[model samples]
Target: MNDVSFLPHARLDDLIQLLLTQGFRVIGPRVRAGVIAYDTIDAATQLPWGWRDAQAPGRYRLEQTAGSRCFAWANGAQAIKPFLFAPREPLWQARRAAGCFEVQELVPPPRPLAFLGVRACDLAALAIHDRHFLGGLHPDPYYAARGEEMLLIAVNCTHPADTCFCAATGDGPQAAAGFDLALTELDDGFVAQAGSQEGRELMQALVLAPATPEQRAAASQAIGLAAAAQTRRLPAPERLRRLYQRLDHSRWEDVGARCLSCGNCTQVCPTCFCHREQDVPALEGEATVHERQWDSCFSAGHAWLHGYQVRPEIRQRYRQWLTHKLAGWQAQFGRSGCVGCGRCISWCPVGIDLTEEVEVLLAEAADGA
Candidate 1:
């Protein structure tokens, strides 16, 4: 089967219908309360057509255009992370019996999901999560169940936000891999490619014609322009690996002065995987439910130990998060945790740009040398 095909804008609903027939709950990007967010969709009309977003440090705004594009925006406040690594979930339930207690694991049943318009940076983050949750010595059954059968339909980025730096992270502007189907949106239609057996079967079912050379070239050129337009960048991995050694760097104190300690960066970050667990007792005292929710190193409670906080100061917490995200993550996962999606920059109330912080921190080290 030919991997590359042209899907006319009009026939997009046909593809959604086919996924529905295959028992997938199709989720796509939609304009919700003036923001492009992922939601369930039954037809192509639900997509944010002719909509674009302008993003900057501590700012995001929606703009309407006279175009027919559905994915002209960069990304939303949240990624597919919440879908797999649920913000809050019950781990187990304990029932009090006549003589003993019975525990029931609360692993959720797998639901087939088809996500449309996944960005390349998000795909890279998803790969890091796969390594964290599934490639560990003890696999996370909860995350595994949710992600095992998920279908990824990637949309190559052509309109990157000013805050976006996926190109510097080597993760974006084009869909390189980790997708079933990849689409490059054009004004008239989309240039689609199948990356998996299931994706090939679906393309065959769509019966789309092979994309013309002109269409393919246009898509490639648009992605290239998008890449070139990004002004933000992160230091190379080699320099980032030394970030932990700068624990007492003055930049930490400088950034900490403006930091809110609100953990918004960790929450918006695509690859931050800290979580906390607690047990909730039932009102009747007959049961207790153990639940886990997302956590952040920015929280004072995260470093709590023996009734004392290890990172009590805001500067220490800020340093901890930055060093761990850029340096410690490499030691543990063989890659930096940041995928350069820039959600941390735009969603932050104070707009603490980690890329800017890293450059300043590393530049000082080079000058001192």
Candidate 2:
């Protein structure tokens, strides 16, 4: 741990201004369409000041807080994934020529961004994405280019949403690493600590005072209480493999029936990265545009093969998503796909909870064994 400093709550916007002065686009939590989501901001006044959110399975509502706290909400439907791996991007375009077609790969717009109010679970998800995209056998040039230079200013979650379970997964309430700067908001101000050279330089520019021992203790206490407050948890890590044994179990059919196959879970999932490519040809047959768009397992065409679909049933689709997220992902990626953010639970229109489904399967597998 590095030396900590005190950033007064009233001057929190100073950090935003500082980032902007350094030629960085600042993106922070803001209220839009009645929910808190990360959006671009030019000044601190745009942040969701004095706002908090209430979330549950298939439900979400926003309310005003009593004080002028900037980040009372735990999370919203959006995460930092959208910034790194965008929803829609043009891959390449082809134009007809005399005897051949000319193809060119499209480059993403260049912009260095600073993310604000990011939580620990979201940080964990970003790490998983980094491993999958940057550390893979074939590195993704698109992700590598966009994710390379951004600054991550993370916030240690002091308020855990009811649906949150990052503590159980050992991923959240407080971020231990993978951030340039981490913040713990207290009543009077924020206890800010730098994790990288950039963070240190930024803090020095702000000319903040060193945090007193008492303030540090208060920050620690705030994080501890947030961890203790989490009510949801995944099953034991060793027991997660049991999910594979119960693929044929009846629980999948039950959940599938209620699932609308709307793909809301994947949309809101912080770690999900499924996508498909499309080609748009010109009416004159002179040019064709190739674009990549986000896709989900719940979609009917996701499993299409050579004139056939692999998963034709909704139960099978649901099972594929669950099995991959909890069990198969570990085998393929050396880590669990889920970070326990609980966005999937809250955003699902039918209120499907992966944690509850895992419990049922584990119990059934235990009885059968």
Candidate 3:
């Protein structure tokens, strides 16, 4: 941990302006359509300054929020996987003119990026995905390039939705790692801290001033306040794992009766990294290209193969997804894939709260016994 640089309240925008001067396309959240979503911005005017969101099972909506609400918005429908893995992308191009087939490996887009206003839960999710994609049997070249060549500016959550469960897992409202820089919006200014080398460089280049002892204390207290304000909390991690092992089809069916397999839960989830692939013909008369797109297990075709779908039954798919997220992920990556960002809960059109679901399962299991 390097000595973090800080600046007076007035020099805040200068930090963003500084990143732009360095040729990085900085992205943060702003009000768009009916909600706040991440996008490119040049100044504070474009961000969701005093706004926040209301999320629940099968629902998500933004409300004119109060306070120094830089992260007033809770969770967005989109996550980092789409940008890192791309919903759909060509893997390679090929041509079979007369007899022999020719192929060319795809080179992904070169976009040096810096993500701002990111929450700690999202950071945890990214770490889980990184473990699967980069530390697994096969590494994705395209995802690796984007992930490896970017900066993370995490924001400690000042507001959490009713669905957030990160605190239950000891992940955060405050980020202790994986960020180049972390920012906490203050009433009079912002509190910035450097957790990595790149973060130190960012602060130095921006020429921000050193944080006062007061600012540091405020930042720490603010983070604790946010966590204490959470509305949802998961059971013990060991209990969560046992809950999965005790799954029963009848109870799952009752839950599945409400789940439309619309995939909003998985879609908004920051760590759900499953995806499908495809191939397309090039504009020229002689070539074809391979593609990779984001996939969700809840989708009907996700389990499909040559003749039959692997987990054709909806009940099976639902159970598999829940089990993998809460249990198998720990074994596979030594971390729970869920970061408790609550995107799944808030974004679901029908408001299917996962915490409630887990509790229901536990209750039913106990009653059955």
Query: In TM-score terms, which candidate is top?
Result: 1
Better of 1 and 3 by lDDT: 1
Model 1: per-residue Cα lDDT over 1-369, one tens digit each: 789999999999999999999999898998898788888999999999999899999998999898888988899988889999999999999998997999999999999999999999999999999998999589999999998789999999999999999999899978899999999999999999998998898899999999999999999999999999999988878888878778778888899899999999899888999999999999999999999999999998999999999999999998989888888888898888888899999988998888899988898676444
Across 1-369, the per-residue lDDT of candidate 2 in tens digits comes to 345899998778899988998888888998999889899998878987788888888988899877667877789998989988989988889998998999998867667889988999999999999988888589887888787669999999988788999999989889989999998988778999998989998888888899989999999998999899988889766678678888789888899899999999999999999999999899998999999899999999999999899999999999999988888888877778888899999999888888888888888566546
| Cand. 1 Cα-lDDT | 0.92
- RMSD values for the candidates in order, in angstroms, are 1.0, 1.5, 2.4
The lowest-lDDT stretch of 10 consecutive residues in candidate 3 is 1-10
Error of 2 at 201 (Å): 0.8
Error of 2 at 48 (Å): 0.9
lDDT of each: 0.92, 0.88, 0.77
Model 1 segments more than 4 A misplaced: none
**Model number with the top lDDT:** 1
State how far residue 41 of model 3 sits from its true place (Å).
2.0
Model 3 CA deviation exceeding 4 Å by range = 1-5, 65-68, 282-285, 364-369
* TM-score versus the correct structure, for each prediction: 0.98, 0.97, 0.92
Q: Per-residue lDDT of 150-256 in model 3, one digit per residue for the tens? A: 88888888777777778877788888788988888777766788888888887877777777888888878888988888878776656666766566646688777
Sort every candidate by TM-score, greatest first. 1, 2, 3
Report model 3's TM-score to 2 decimal places.
0.92
